[model samples]
Target: MLNWDDISREYQSEIENFQMLNTPDERNVRAFLQNCALELHERQTAVTRLYFDQEDKLVGFFSLHNDLVKVSPSLILEHRWNLITEGLTHFPAIKLHYLGVDARYRKQGVGKYLMEEVRSIAKEISNYSGCNFITVEALHSSLTFYRDRGFKLKDSTAEFHNMLFSLETLDNPTLEATPLISKQKIQEIRDKVMSVIEQSNLTYAQVAATSGLDEIVIEQMEFGTDVDVETLASVCQSLGIRFL
Candidate 1:
């Protein structure tokens, strides 16, 4: 069992004692949860959600705030701008500021559960506002996790990449359930490749062997890791696929 509460003074001490001992990133997550999360929460600048285990030990937490998503002129030119936006370029969005799980709870689905909670909250936000996207500045190591959940790269800086998930994707009748592939460029490629592989008898290991690429490479590709064009071509060839 678990309990969810917004960050509050009642849990301040518990929040402070929350441990995230693993990587430099984990330490930073803990630092924010202890030092800054409450301040931001009180100011209403962001909402911080805390989750606890059956034993009442802090398990994980995440923060969120309102944001904006800007449609690039290039994208507007690529699509029917008027049909989709009606002269709008900036749309309301929700930004996930931070998501962290205690190192002790790693691999227990804590992260995924918290992410789904965020998604639910974002969807509710969309219902009342013009918000249509959930955005995040994702760490390099977590890119595959976001991508596997239907997020797409929107932009990037030296330190982090900006990724966004369209809420509209959830309402598509053709896709009754959430599929990792959204109607975006990279996701389209992922959908095609994965769909082909799922339909064929060939295993990922065989594809890697036939392509003469490492199995890890195939695994990375399937999980939305960026691979070079030649490497992608090789894998596609082995899978009897040709990108048109």
Candidate 2:
């Protein structure tokens, strides 16, 4: 089981215990979570979110802030470029300041889950404002990781590689539809998922393993967390629960 929430002082002790790979970039990630994440959060400079695993131990975290991406005209689609002013190239973006998963959870989809959450948050922000992309200053060693996840390098020669993921690749539900999701509706869905889980008498881990997903994924569904529809469908199928 894994859960995420905004960072707070109560997590200081756990944050102190958090560990990452020994590489320089991973070290900086740990240092940021310990030394700066909360302060930055308090100041409203950057908002940080922490991930905790089954034992309620802090295992991962990431910080995000609003940003602007300046690029040449050629870099953007003509229609997108046309949305900008005659001379300006700045595009609204959400910057991922730091992202790190515990060294122990590295290959178990923690990183992938964190990235998905970031992208989901970016999309939600897009519904309220003009968020066109998610940007990150990538470490050289992690270049391939980000690249494989749909981020494109803005400049290979830069000290910190600038990577961008165009949000246009994701579906943009109409504004009317966005506001239609009320808490009650969300609770109903969660209850439905729980009912299905109870009927199946299968644990989250069992369904997750059969569905090729993390146990936390099923837990998230039952807890009313926002999950991709594909994941929801897969979990349902795994439990022999049909969608109406």
- lDDT for 166 in candidate 1 is 73
TM-score of 1: 0.67
Task: Put down candidate 2 lDDT per residue, 162-196, tens digits, no spaces.
Answer: 88888876664221211234546545656777797
lDDT of 1 by residue, 54-171 (tens): 9888999999999988967575455323326667778788999999888678656677788879888999977888787888988654555676566777787755778877776666
lDDT of each: 0.73, 0.75
Name the top lDDT candidate: 2
Determine the backbone clash count of candidate 2.
0
lDDT agreement of model 1 with the native = 0.73
| Model 1, backbone clash pairs (residues 3+ apart or across chains), number | 0
> Which 10-residue window in model 1 sums to the lowest lDDT?
173-182
- Model 2: CA > 4 A from native: 77-86, 172-244
